[model samples]
Target: MRLTILAPLVAALFIAFTQPAQAERVDSGVPGMLFDHDVPVAMNDGAKLSINIYRPDKPGRYPVLMLMGPYGKDTTMADAPAYRTSWAKLIAKYPDLCKKSSCRYIRFEAPDPERWVPSGYVVIHADVRGAGASPGVLDPFSPRETQDYATLITWAAHQPWSTGKVGLLGTSFQAINQYQVAALRPEGLAAILPWEGAFDQYREIAYYGGILNVAWQFWWEHQVVPNQNGNAGTPLIDSIGGGKDTGLPLSQERLKDNRIDPVGAFARHPFDDAWYHERTPDGRRITVPLLDVANWTDWSTQGYLAAASRQKWLRIQTGDHLTPFYSDQALALQKRFFDHFLKGIDNGWEQEPRVAVQVRHRDGTTWRNEKAWPLPDTNWEPYYLDAASGSMGPTFEAAAPAAKSWPGLGEGLTFTTAPFVNETEFTGPVALRLWVSSSTADMDIFAAVRLIDPEGRDVTFMGNSDPNVPLDLGYLRVSHRAVDPANSTAWQPFHPHVAAEPMTPGQLYPVDVEFMEPTSIVIPKGYRLALTIQGTDFGYGPGAPIVHAKDYDLPDDSHSGLFFAAHPNRDPALYGGTDTIVTGGKHASYLLLPHVPPRS
Candidate 1:
């Protein structure tokens, strides 16, 4: 935790000049855009949070697009090495990314001020308390942080340069908080666009089907801690303030005392209890106009469906997460959405289709607009798994009872469908119903829906972080198989991870595993669809190894880097052993897919 220290006199000098609540105006580097640096907005608790504003130089009144998060407002995309490398690769791939705008003044995962300011919008980036220039405890997504956001939304709306209408926009962390504060129905909050942001903290992120995802621990340690407000060693320099220090430096012990350990909190509360509920958004209360964007390769799907807004739309696109957000086409779509909602323009946006899906095929992608998600004409088909021949078909083969056994830490089994007789499309939610027995007290199940080409090669796509990701993935721990009947649907089963019911060794138990997100892929006449059942995380070759020695052991290079769901912390005595999948006259193990017919 040691950081680069400044001389005592120099440190004191920097604090005296930088910690004040004065606003400094400067050239925004982008033509026609003005920068207001270190603008402080008072929170309800009397603490002033720092915000940097970017707007048209001669703005009368314009709609506001605000992005608030722990990622420092002064931190440009190039400030973080990881982001810088990714941005370079993205630019190399998509040459037209920055054609319309200069791409300058773009913060990580936030909107580019250069792009939006010239579009008659005021762009504001606020630092969450305890991060960047804001001062307070650095507890992210807590009730206090949510309240600060709501207050800021209202404050921005009433500003002299604002049209009294504010719309929320950004990706990931920036998009996540929009759901929380929007639930409060703050005044002048016109609309929100949450792109690839997880809604349910417990199910979607912390615990994936009751299996702990260790990525959050890595995220906090590697990405978050270094950017705390008082860290002099923060790589980010104030680009707007002529390369000044982002914040005053604080002692290591003081920094540690100022922030709560999120990973520890997650370990303590494994269930979907009040602590998680407090952080998750109550979508029923969100009545603002909403445009929820999802990536075909990411795991954020529930926000649009959960929102109660009458004027809501879902746009599911393809490609890696951050790249798509800054693409030319995505920018146009975002501008159209904001123009209709925030600017009160009659742009016929309301008349457009409610759902837009990019149907992917081996050749390319086809954009299709639908009236609703899961398509009204979705044919929910079940392909029964036959363990005897490792095959899957529509009808269950009424043969003698059979079972397939695989070690808990090994590559389990794959059931392949006979090649498609006709070009077929499967483009929505997927589920798996299985009857299983574990040699140990409990077992972890990892299921992947994949595509096999006519040449017998595995078809993979670029995931949010992983370069090779399957069509869809699902996970379930036998101990946490208790389903909530009220929330469970035919295609999606909702598991209430409140209590863990240990499985009796050698006894069969039926469980429905729900894929975290929907997928869209079109199979050619000869292409085949496959279902892989495994114990550990799904990977390219032999898959992730089960290491019981260390609790926080990360996956090797062979596994999906950030998206791997390996539960190393679980007791080996209880989870290690052989797992059996039985399919016969009564067991009826099957894979459920959404078969969408082509539009006329």
Candidate 2:
């Protein structure tokens, strides 16, 4: 068979990717950063958003670094066994990670006052609206909420301790909201530093591809429960208010008028329409200077890879979503960026490389710098699928096209490559071109790229939401496969998700599925790379620790990290049927990888 011949060539050509020579490390340390907790700012629409100001104690005017999100501004930093373990792991690898104050006072995702305040910057944190001590309804990541961010940014620039220059900083909710506000181009907004934030509401946040995601249901319910200003006897609000009322004394009946139902809205709109578009940013309109940060291991990996702006720089790290925001190297980069734009410091930031990346190997990760992303010299290699052998190789014969089917809503088919004879590495965006047919009118494709060790064990990484997760995952609703040629590249395809084109049962349709995260994986000789085509997340087990949204915890913290909701489409009647993948000849299917050739 043709498969037998190509396997040897694939092994022979497999070579490890190269790491870049080290670049100079930049650090700008100051005495300390200070703060003023629970400051309130009044919005033009007569809403009050809670704010926390962190600035120099010396009282001189300075540029403001503001973070606004649905997470309560009053949340405190505390110790946990897991967090302590993460800290120990980080410090053990990089001893200088804590060279300055550990910035221990910094809450989970907000800017650390200990670092920024001492560096001639004022760090501000605020509860957007309908959350924390802020009064109103909880309509998160909405246009109205985004406008409120702009209003708050303008408010900080005029403060007595502010220099009238402002920049945005934070992670997840704090970071993603900047895309919306930046498009509005608020006055005094100098730049943004969005770390692992989503810009597309439909594809990035609520729905993956077109199927509804229940992975964040528990997080969604608990994050806003305790922090509502009018809620009676909530510990966080009560503590901040000294046992008194936290905000305007609106009755329970009146307070109910202020919130929007996110889950209900999701159910009402199953497709990407005006509702999702309004929340998503207009990328073309975002012209602010950007220091967009992303991690190789997060769900928000797509946002960072697709980040676009006139003056933008990217910094990619290797860790879970929250790690980059807390790392010492990351903080140094953030301060250096703010210093140049906000304080007029001649820090030579303009001369810095446009892209800095962390290339991950199983043994360890190496840092590399480049002038742009997707390395200009990249050799885009395609590995053809051989359905008969359940494997991937460099070539396949067209005479015998093959098809395989599996339960549409269960563990689906997987194709693995043979053990490598030499070390091989994969970096950058990955694309799956498939010739698929579903027994039903529509199908959802969930594709995952996995690492297989020499022992045949799966090598996992820390995902944005869950620990011990696969290297990368992507999804596509077959009907939503129409591409936006104007914005899409060969390596990364852009699907508009605007209209659905249903398929006739058993009719093969060519579909492009884009894996959201850009990854760097090094496979040693005797190791393999596997691709799983499934309808759900690759699971570890039922007892895995649940990861929730920021500040996501129950009142009693009992079911704080639980995932309770099920996907609406994951049912026997709705989405359970056979799905087929065809390969060879006109139905040529392949995996597109960004293959970086090793240095000569």
Candidate 3:
């Protein structure tokens, strides 16, 4: 009886292993459209990666638009359970999302094949080395992954029914890798569009001013791990056929062994080092034409300015990161860009303005085109801080030195400006200089620029991910305050973050904090601009709480999902002490803002 029982179980396992894998051919549900899934492309190391192709059924040769990322290429927007809420909100806000096509075939943060294929383009999506259907070790944005992306680009260019030119398109993760691969200057790469993606891995995301963003732990556990290759119970299933979208299943222990722990890596390396340098893009090496789209409240313009591309354009828009990329207006802009660069259509794209900004006002936003960033005629003005009266103003008059103190881990201080007498527009980078002292050896400073209405209500806007966000934000750890003199500018201070210089307790030191990203706001008459200097993460107002990383806990009174700088491993003895800000006479502290003048 024991032999009989064992024989059946062994037979079942043998049969499961003997069956051939299913072919990935399905009707694209669109006239004259062909869908080819799981096309293999080999790397130099003999590792095979998979890609999905959507092209016109009668195509001879066409320019290619590609997206390569860890997000599953096989997972459709309508079928992805993880993005259910985001998809619903997208549809509710933009009902015309399906007017061009059913929108069922569009992958998350990727282009809709139905929209591009009919317009004489071949759209392709690839599963990065160790995600989705591809099988390998999972390491995101690694040098090895960048190499594989370059290899894929060459492969797409030489395909039987493809043009030699390929253009990169997508949002967020899809866009982040574009910068890295483009730096390689790979063959057949015609152009790139990096939208709302950070170029500096260390400064922009992992460690904001030397303070670790623990929310990355949540991002890895929730968004990335579930879609990792060989994950056993991935919720993402093939929309055309009901089955797992990832590869064969692996045990939880095996899965853990095959991937790098991003959070653990971040904890080990607190400074900018070789590990981050290997992952970040060297913009000087990127020579392809570029169209960099930045959200007004999200990423910065550093990457755009660093690129060596002579034919480059910048468009700054106001909206959450994902919505604007798929809007009808944005879609048209992308098509026109690709049509000129990839197809050599001569669509007058070269004549387009170098900078396009959607200037945010009290009621809404307005469009403005300029020849360059920071507006050539910008008036760099200093607003002096007054510690005695908790006020900030344009003029600086000598007065007796004064100081204000607050708990290091509590709501610190707010210096408000008198209500404006005229409509004032602040349309560029911002910097904050402060003379600070801590009771302990070190402290962290969190600064935010906020708008106050005539009725004293705080004005907020929808950020990249969070609904309620301030005008702009900056952070600095007093210990890691060394600035790179070569890169330091009046409008922006570049921190090398190479070493930590612990502070002498109660000894005042001046630190300049750059607001990393730019903002465009028009303050109307009777409105006040306030700067809040705090020790903890900026709190969110009443609205839908940041749901993306809600599982992560914050400090007692602080609540934030994005731009979270509260480190879990920080020592209370070192950072949880009283903090002081000094201002007046010799110790002058002020906020530097870029004031743009009206066009002639």
Best by lDDT: 3
The digit string of per-residue lDDT tens for model 2 on 1-600 reads 111111112222212112211222212133444545565566666666777776676857889888886656555433322234445544555566455665444555777677667667788778768777677777877767877787777777766777889999888788888877887677679988888777677776667676665655554556554556666644543323345224655666765676666766776777778888777776766678888887675544444444456678887776666655666767788888988989889999989888888877765678888777777777788878888889886665442688888888777888888888888777788888999998888877877787788777766655554545566777888888888889888877888777778889989999999676677877678978888886555555544343322222212121111122255655665467688999888888888887787755
Worst 10 residues of 2 by lDDT: 554-563
- Candidate 1 lDDT over 281-362, as tens digits, reads 7888778999999877664768898889999999887767887788778888899999999888899998878998988887
- lDDT scores of the candidates, listed in order: 0.80, 0.69, 0.81
Error of 1 at 306 (Å): 0.6
Clashing pairs in 2: 137-258, 137-259
Model 2 has a clash total of 2
Measured against the true structure, the TM-scores of the candidates, in listed sequence, are 0.92, 0.85, 0.93
Clash-forming residue pairs, model 1: none
Q: Give the TM-score of candidate 3.
A: 0.93
Model 3 Cα shift for residue 560 (angstroms):
4.8
Q: Write the per-residue lDDT of candidate 3 for residues 288-358, one digit (tens) a residue.
A: 99999987676757679878899999988876788788888888999999999999998889998999999
* Higher-scoring candidate on TM-score, 2 or 3: 3
Whichever of 1 and 2 has more lDDT, that candidate is 1
Ranking by lDDT: 3, 1, 2
